[model samples]
Target: MPAPERIPPGRVSSVDLLAKGELTVRGRVREASNAVLYCSVSYEGEQAHCVYKPVAGERPLWDFPDGTLAQREVAAYELSEATGWGLVPPTVLRDGPYGQGMVQLWIEADPSESLLALVEDEEPGEGWKAVGFAEVGEGRTALLVHADDVRLRRLAVLDAVINNGDRKGGHLLPTADGNLYAIDHGVTFNVDDKLRTLLWGWAGEPLPADASRTLTELAATLTEGAPLATRLAELLTSAEVEALRGRVGVLLGAGVHPLPSGEWPAIPWPPV
Candidate 1:
């Protein structure tokens, strides 16, 4: 395994300084027990929108400190870039008088057409039912009916290999054109049993053809001599890479409809 890519550190420009006067506040995007996310109009002309995440004031149930959380978020973005998956884009981590926060690319919110909305509009079929998760609203089920979709399923597998603990329904955004995008990957790459998530509801199922191909390509990209492999090695240890490889092998062996276990929580709360 090679070293993971290093993200450059910098301070985000002061929002207060930028917003001299008459800056209208956009509607709140999300507010949860751990963090509050807001969309705001930028003072500068270059960027129109920015997403803000304030520091967690109280001690969290999870073990990550503020700095570690910020670093993980940055690392996840870098990995997403390397993998060509729109999991999360580049973000600016900032520390100010208010405390720590992250300024990321603002995703345009559609007219309540997210994946969660789609699930809420339909009834759960034979293999679907709502799980006790915050993001799964009323009438929404967590089961993956199109589990056979190779691209989507493979992305899920990659997520699992990364030990992403937050794969909530809300984090999965469906574009107007029907492409799915993943967001909020703060609780990942930890060396612990904290691999909780809502995906893998269909474990042991056969991998879709396209998913297998993507995984194969991803594995090749992570080989010893590859740039991606070198980048990952810097960010992760040899043991972590071995674990990731093991997860990939398991997913490749499993098909598209394996059952999920009930031991772990369906998703990570306060998704950062």
Candidate 2:
């Protein structure tokens, strides 16, 4: 498949506008386990309403260290930017209403369209595939689906490179303009193999040429003496960064989509 067209970055300066922006809490998103609040962030006469997750409000997890998820979110954005895929929303770590944490641009999605419903449709839409089935009640069922869009396929490759451990269906947001913004990347960049996603639709398929080239470039940038690696060091441990570099090498060697290891889950719980 041809490479997804690379969207040129705007004439605007490359600034962490949201991070430096004045943030005010509009309301809390009760659905999140941690304190994720919706807020209006204003900076340099520009204003945007976005999600804010304060480090002080973070709920501890045994698998991940405390006060680090916020940093991991930023790290995810950094990796996304380096990939030039524009798959993740603009995110940064900054001091917010409560304390220091993550702030991300809010994606405006078509609420009328639901991924769950589309996946469970008796006849699935074009460019989409059913990965597995979900048991509802006796004899009742639902299907888990993922898009075949090149951007999404690239994102699946990106998830593997970052060791993303939790990629739930609800984390995908399709904007009104057909852009897909992936969010909630707090559990990422582990030194171990923790990839858990719902994007195995193309498993075992050869990695597209464009995807392979991009991964190759990313692998180069992640090596010692590279600027991207320097930036990653500030967000992740040395070991974790090395692990990321290792995954890049592994992906380059495999040259094909990965299948479930069966040692760990291939999908997230509460998939949607």
Candidate 3:
């Protein structure tokens, strides 16, 4: 593993640290599909852990253009910020050990947080929402469910807007401070309908007041010359940006959570 470079003592923000600091690869997240590097960044004596996904390491997907996943991940962060939801950790696009990539602040998940679970009963019970049934092993199946959490609900809305292709349970991070952050958004923002996720609990339900309001504000922010629209233009194609705006408009018009279109698999493989 490479070591972080030494720097003088000074204070800088997390985003600045990730962007300007010396990035040293501490290890690899072996379970990740892409080259997810666990790295330490230091600038002016400020340090933080982050996940770096170099564009070169991204595997070519038939649906998405080559070398665009990193930018898509950054785009997801931008949309999350625009929603004022703070659902995504601080993220930036910058050069790293391998090359330019998406660098995002790492968040430690609280082990005790019970956000998702498998239940034997048909119903998800109070305070929980059913995703569907899943095969556990040995021909037995269990009900997969997630918390009817306000935070997770907001994330579902964000996922819908981003056309997130993958929103597995493992991507959710619940910190000790009770903050929930979602990660691994590289498979997002496709021009096609790819909003696969485990957050279908609220599907077809009426949109929450806060979510409706956020979508309304987001629609205005996505206007041609708006700041959010301008930033997205840099990361995504014009058609993709237009699709995003269209999704938001559809959500606003529906006034309810969207149901899966059934054109493709509604949930990701390996739900966790």
Winning candidate number (TM-score): 3
Candidate 3: segments with Cα more than 4 A from true spot: 1-11
lDDT of 1 at 184: 67
Which order, best to worst by TM-score? 3, 2, 1
**lDDT tens readout by residue for model 1, 48-92:** 454455555323644554445544555566556655665564555
Report lDDT (CA) for all predictions.
0.52, 0.81, 0.92
Pick by lDDT: 2 or 3, better one: 3
Q: Residue 120 error for model 1, in Å? A: 11
Clashes of each: 21, 0, 0
lDDT of 3 by residue, 11-115 (tens): 687778889989989899999989999999888867878889999999999999999999999999999999999999989999998999999988888889989
Cα deviation in Å at residue 241, candidate 3?
Answer: 0.3
In angstroms, the error of model 3 at 69 is 0.4
Residue 250 C-alpha lDDT in model 1: 59
Error of 3 at 173 (Å): 0.4
Using Cα atoms with residue i matched to residue i, what is each candidate's TM-score against the true structure? 0.62, 0.90, 0.95
Residue 16 displacement in candidate 1 (angstroms):
22
**Error in Å for residue 133 of model 2:** 1.8
Report the Cα lDDT for candidate 1: 0.52
Task: Provide the global lDDT of candidate 3 against the true structure.
Answer: 0.92
- For model 2, state the Cα shift of residue 76 in Å: 0.4
Candidate 2 local lDDT, 114-164, one digit each (tens) = 544434576457877667777777898877676667767888898988888
